[model samples]
Target: MEIKDLSGMRKDYVSEDFSEKSLLADPYLQFDKWFAEASLVEEFEANAMVLSTSGSDNRPSSRVVLLKKYSKDGFVFFTNYLSRKGREIDENPWCSLLFFWPHRVRQVRVEGVAEKIVYEDSLEYFKSRPVISQASSSLSLQSSILEDKERFDKMIESLVSSGEDIKMPPHWGGYIVKPERFEFWQGGTGRSHDRFRYDLEEDHSWRISRLYP
Candidate 1:
């Protein structure tokens, strides 16, 4: 196969404009409205989001994680506590989450502090997962080097065959991100996108502002 030139690749966004009047006074409610709309389409993983974190060394990393829940309080996702991202969050609680829905020509950026949810919550979600997923989560040590795939597979098989109740690993749980800032972006004609940012005020209200794009 010949390598193709990539310079010409581009798409012009000509979606409807997002205006302040259409925004909810509460940023959380605004997010819910957009998420609800995105959830209606079947093409993409509407709940998938890019979580970015920085450790004490100031080096940053990003990975895609599925958003399990969201509400006025915060956004929630699950992970192994000993994973790289988990360790990074331990060192620095502050992180950012990015969600992009190209089909809708929209994106949401969230900045916040992450805090672990109660263990009971994690257990509840774990129990709701498929048995195979439970086995994988129970057997695999996330972020650790695996020397043998066959061994891992055998372990999972053993767990499945044993017919024992699979429990949530002690190292696995959920984190809730309490957002302090949110930026909502909508693509527009001629590359002129509409952007709005909401910053939490001391008075517990959101101060919304528009940015040139």
Candidate 2:
């Protein structure tokens, strides 16, 4: 395969404008507004976000994951608590979520602490998942070493044959990311991208300001 650097490829477009005042005083409201607008016009995974975490060793890591829910208080997503991301979260609760809607030339970055959802909350959402997914969760020991595909499939089949109630894996749970800061970016040509940042204060109020591109 030939490697071609597309970084130099530039596009010219005279389009949308974003500024400090263009956003709401409440960053959460502004996020909701942008989310709705993007959902209406963009075709890709609107709810997907790049989640970032730090391990016990303080090394940084990130991966794309679906955004499950959000509110004025926090954002919620589910995963196996024993997985890599989960272990990272357990060791260091702080995390960040990034959302990009390329078609709309917009991106949002959120930073916060991650906390486990209530057991009942986790149970409710777990039960709402597809039956097959529930079964997989029960059969899988997330982050555990496995021998091969044969062993994995056999475990799943054994669980299926038992025909017992598939209890929620104790290691499976949901985490809420209570955002302390949010940065909004709207792309512009010549690297003059529009950017705004909203930081939360101790009073639970937000301070919104425009940032250098």
Candidate 3:
């Protein structure tokens, strides 16, 4: 197989221009607006976001997670508490979430502190999941090394045959990121992108600023 070298890959962003004056005072509202637009696009997963977390060792890791919900409170996503990212969040609650919409040449970066949501909330979400998903989540040991596929299959088989209600694992739940900062980016032609950041103030008001890009 010949190795292909591709150094000339780029796309000129000609999407609608974003301006500071057009942004909402509240970052959450602004995010909602962008998300709603993204949702209307059939080709994109509007709720998918990259969650980045750091551990006590200061090593950072990121993974793609679905945004289950969002509001004035924060962005919510579910995961196994024993997962690598979960442990990292336990060690260091501060994290960042990045949402990239390449089709629209837009991105949203969020920095916040993550905390596990209440058990009742987790249970409600868990119950809404399909039975297969519930079974897999309950039986699977996330972020753990798997020696063989047989064991995993057997566990799922047993869970299915037992006909027991698949309950949420004690270590499985949702986490909400309480954002303190948000940066919205819109790609532009000539590599001159539009960037705006909203910082939460002590008085609970958001201060917006435009950045050179």
Q: Distance from true position, residue 73, model 1, in Å?
A: 1.1
**Residues 1-213, model 1: lDDT tens digits:** 999999999888867858977878889998998999888873878999999999999999999999999988899999988999999999999999999988789999999999999999999999999888899998889999999999999999999999999988899989999999999999988888999999999998999999987
Error of 2 at 142 (Å): 2.7
- Candidate 2 wrongly placed segments (more than 4 Å): 1-3, 157-163
- TM-score for every candidate vs. truth? 0.96, 0.90, 0.95
Worst 10 residues of 3 by lDDT: 37-46
On TM-score, the stronger of 1 and 3 is 1
Tens digits of lDDT, candidate 3, 135-164: 889987899998988988888888877888
Strongest candidate by TM-score: 1
In candidate 1, stretches whose alpha carbon ends up further than 4 angstroms from where it belongs are: 1-5
lDDT of each: 0.93, 0.88, 0.92
Lowest lDDT 10-mer window, candidate 1?
A: 14-23
Error of 1 at 148 (Å): 0.5
> Which sequence of candidate numbers ranks them by lDDT, best first?
1, 3, 2
How much is the lDDT of residue 191 in candidate 1? 88
Measured with C-alpha atoms, the lDDT of residue 37 in candidate 2 is 88
